[model samples]
Target: MRTIAALELADCRRIAAAAEAMAAQHQASVSLAICDGGGHPLLVVRLDGASPSSTAVAMAKARMAALNGKPTADQEAAINGPRPALLQLAGVFKEGAVAMGGGLPLLHSDTCIGGVGISGMTPELDGAIAAAAAAALQGQPG
Candidate 1:
């Protein structure tokens, strides 16, 4: 078996911080979540005024990104493409996976180490927050 890099507490902190900053910049009340490569949650934050449901949505987005190694928006596009029926059938096998625009995989050395998810605002803003968090991971050691 081969070993893979994993996210540490510091990494989680950085992701949360960046996501929070993004939310603040956008004036959005949002929820952010981070998950391990295996799709296990590591950290979750709900900004002031964010709805309770945002937390669950954030977690699901993070899991989708980590497990699929791609942005949730891309997954959304795939699921809505011409062959959507086939994609939906496949999605049935990947329970809890969602097609949304607020999740991004955390990459280290071109390998997915974790993921970040954001919710509460529009899908565009949520995706921006998640992207900021994922970008913050760059240049940091795994």
Candidate 2:
């Protein structure tokens, strides 16, 4: 059997803190979510002033990224470009892959470990925060 690294609880806390710091930097209120390799939730934070609906949306985005092992924005672009038919398949997946610009996959040594997602602010800000969270994972010392 092969061995791979997985995110620990401390890693999740670091990711959440990174995401929150990025959101605060932009004065944006958003929902942040982190998930395990299997798309299981690890941490979720809904900042003050964020929309109530953002919680579930953020979770779905995180799960989508974790399951797909890629950024959710890629799917968004594909569906918006020349694969609109993909929209019909969203409900078919266990984790609803939202075609948005705020979800990022967590990869370590080329192995996907989990995902980070942010919502409630503009897509730009959400994406920024998610990216920050992913960076935190990368910055972790092995």
> Best candidate per TM-score, number?
2
Candidate 1's TM-score reads: 0.89
* Candidate 2 C-alpha lDDT tens digits along 1-142: 9998889999999899888888888999899989888888889889999998998889888888888787888878988999887676457675655868899899999999898889898877788889888988889422
Q: State the lDDT at 34 in candidate 1.
A: 96
Off by over 4 Å in 2: 140-142
Alpha-carbon local distance difference test for all models: 0.85, 0.85
- Candidate 1, poorest ten consecutive residues by summed lDDT: 86-95
Note the clash tally of each candidate: 0, 0
**Count: clashes, candidate 2:** 0
RMSD to the true structure for each prediction, in A, is 2.8, 2.3
- Give candidate 2's error at residue 71 in angstroms: 0.8
lDDT of 1 at 67: 83
Residue pairs in collision within model 1: none
Q: TM-score for every candidate vs. truth?
A: 0.89, 0.92
